[model samples]
Target chain A: MSIIIDQLNYTYSPGTAYEKQALKDISLVIEDGEFIGLIGHTGSGKSTLIQHLNGLVKATGGSVYYNGADIYDADYNLKELRTKVGLVFQYPEHQLFETTVLKDVQFGPKNLSLTPLEVDLRAYGALKQVGIPDDLIDASPFELSGGQKRRVAIAGVLAMEPEVLILDEPTAGLDPKGRDEILDQIAKIHDERHITVILVSHSMEDVAKYVGRIIVMDHGRAVFDGAPKKVFSHYKELEGIGLAAPQVTYAVNALRERGILVKTDATTVQEAKAAVLAVWKG
Target chain B: MIRDITIGQYYPADSVLHRLDPRVKLTGTLVYIVSLFLVKNLWGYLIAALALAAVIRASKVPFGYIVKGLKAVVILLLFTVCFNLFLTSGTPVFEWKFIRITKEGLYLAFSMAVRLTLLILGSSLMTFTTTPNELTDGMESLLSPLKKLHVPVHEVAMMMSIALRFIPILLEETDKIMKAQQARGADFESGGIIKRAKAMIPILIPLFISAFRRAGDLAMAMEARCYRGGAGRTKMKPLHYHGRDAGAWITMAMFVAVIVVSRRF
Candidate 1:
């Protein structure tokens, strides 16, 4: 395991009138090269729990260990830790302050104190990884479309060359096509790079298509953590907490409920289609 | 993170103050602020405070919420009281090395604190009863006469209304950005002043860009709707001055006169 969170707790505005316990005793281990999907409703502590992995949020109680070392140890350099576990915030295009997209992408690698030639090489490589065009590299990030700006933001983080990558609601506010494009890009990155990817999303379909393991949270606690098929099997419990399994899984379950033979584990439309075809042919 | 701001908090109520015309409420607030400054004596201060309390009770806003609003400025209030107490030289009630707390000074500090407290409470009363849209409409009507001075009164009011409308949206966006940065291991707390400030760059930069993008989109939308520079613009709901509004103005005039006369004592 590359990241291990043991009984992590987090509270916002800890001593003030606005104090809120956003996370409660969240414990999870993320192994290297695994794609994990984190899903929860608003204010469910999904964001709070993930932030502990990179040292952005210090645990109120318990500890987070990164590669066998406590991240909160006084001797650990946080900036270095951040570089090792890159975070790409939602709508990162907003953080693009450089005059050119290339310069903005170079920011993280430059923070690493790399040679100028190395910085440019890493920046170019990062931009390519996120599928940004060469001609657009020198153009201002502000001039890009909403979806393009999002890609540029992702590239900025990739330039840091972290061992693990975390993204929060990366597809939010995007049209269906835009959402699919970004998700496809991220999936490709995970497949090729073999870096541990933690994706926080509310959409079941996206998680079903991309992540291998699904972690479900409710009211600041991790309630379920398993493969998509195993997690979706607890349909009633998920529905009680205002969450639903992927549409195909729900449809398959409905068919089974109606006394029609179907596999309830079918998560994607393609899988459901294949299962139905097999039953008809039989 | 930005949602914690409590500015322009509106308390929903069905009281007479809530039913009153927003223009009347806006004018009453202006008159009330002027009266607070005019009063210099204990009796005048007490009367103003009493009037504010009456308004607060009539508005039916929770006393706890009003007190919470005051808590934000408690430090400033204390500084004002201390500055007046030790700096004003009069018949010394208590003295220390190079410092004297006088009877007049004590009275001044007490009155000053009461004045500021009542001033904030009174203004909050207006906000609590009046929605931002209504307040902006009232402001536009009130400033309409400034058109003779070539001032774009309607434009200013429209800008204020738009700004007010975006407060919640901006707050929500800020929350999203904060979560996004936090997920990436961008530590926001437990850093030195400079380190903390540098941490804000990731959040702030994204917020500003999004805000600008929103502004651009709003401008285009407005243009598509044929919105000009307030020229020949007609309102959907025109403000009507009624008998009750006139009565409110008269009552406010009397209230101001009472405070001014009480100051002469």
Candidate 2:
């Protein structure tokens, strides 16, 4: 279940007045069940990279292999590739169309050509996985709150039972509570299902909190790919490319500057606090 | 799929036609189209072609670019040609079963094909040179007299401009929604007519919702800024006629007169 990207390059509106190379030569291998964060500034090619993983957008050059199968092969089934690698776009709430949340969530499973009973079961299981309440299952998705509608939209993709789930800026525009709730639910789901989850976000903190591995994209190139601490260490370079490290990274650094000697690589506030406490006890 | 829609697309360039008053371009296009229909004989058509050639030369838009617009209208041209070739009854040039081609029918078909090609070429030139804002401003100014007859000319112009502006946004929305659905295993390409159309519902719904939401937001934003229609509105860049605009009107009149005289004499 590994995805191997080989020297991918993509140009938008190629050869036209508006031609732009959105993704440059980049290669990486993502192992199965790895929780990865794909973060970058807006228009940094993070979204484009994620889209290529599922074959939504074909790269202008290079190839993508999922589970030892070349996706760009002549006979490769792109439709089936999409099922195994589901992508939830930004502002997923706008994708909610069915009258009821249940029906909307079932849309993906139905498209998979599952039996009605199996579709309903998958939909229910997905909604449950997302922590959507039972009372809201039959409710009109449009009538729900913004956060609830977004959850239903996410559930739509989750019902497809994709081995790899990719979400693009899923917490964008949500309140902090809503953002944390969604991210917590995602982390819990990833823990339970062990599906490869790639969360694309602009916020470093959000990625730092959950993902074990973080890939930082700069102008269509993956400039850094490693554990959160390793990526966060190059905060200054990331800021040069229009991305700031999480606030906790700065605090940890500030403490070490003040001679407190806490670990500077603490990615989250809790990690920073624990590091500070450890230094104090010593 | 969205890229196929090339209508009303403006090609920006600095040229005599691009600088001309949009009102002049609009009226000239109308008069030019009228002249195409007014042409009755081969001589009239020759003069018509000459006038179009002159206009196109002055427009500074590339010849190949103008002809490219015909790609979308060729079907209509062929349809007109086919009907005229086989339907008009006259002295038969050739006959085979129910298929017939007559002397007059052949002439009519050829003439119609020329007229339509010229028509598309002429209007496309106008759109290519004039921006949508200028088009609406010209439309509103030209139709201002209708306000006395209870026509909401300003409102109509505003609506047209808004619709034009929303087209690109809606198209982008459609593309995004289509991709989102496709990622969920929605099959849009490999289906029959009905199945394909049914697949479109997922995309169409979100697009319409987003459109309505945008419209609502725009209306609210407009109202917040005290936009109450054209009751007492004044233009930030009010249009004025230059010496060249009058010159263009006279030139257009002369062109049409030539076509009319050729047809009459």
- Any runs in candidate 2 off by more than 4 Å, and if so which? B12-17, B41-82, B94-96, B101-103, B242-254, B261-265
Q: Tens digit of lDDT per residue, candidate 2, span A2-37?
A: 999999999986644446899999999999999999
Q: Which candidate is the best by lDDT?
A: 2
Indicate the worst ten consecutive residues by lDDT in candidate 1 chain B. Answer: B1-10
Native-referenced TM-scores of chain A, all candidate models: 0.98, 0.98
Stretches of candidate 1 off by over 4 Å are A1-33, A40-85, A109-124, A161-164, A173-178, A191-194, A217-224, A234-247, A250-262, A269-282, B9-19, B46-50, B53-121, B141-154, B171-207, B220-258
Highest-DockQ candidate: 2
lDDT of 1 by residue, B1-265 (tens): 3555445666667787877788999989999998998987888988888888887888777676676667668899999999999988889999889889999899889988998888888887888788877888899888989999999998898898788778768877877777555444456786799989997887788789889989999999999999887788777877788787788788888899899899889
Model 1, A199-233: lDDT tens per residue? Answer: 99877888899899999998889999999999999
Return the TM-score for each candidate structure.
Answer: 0.72, 0.90
Interface RMSD values for the candidates, listed in order? 5.0, 2.1
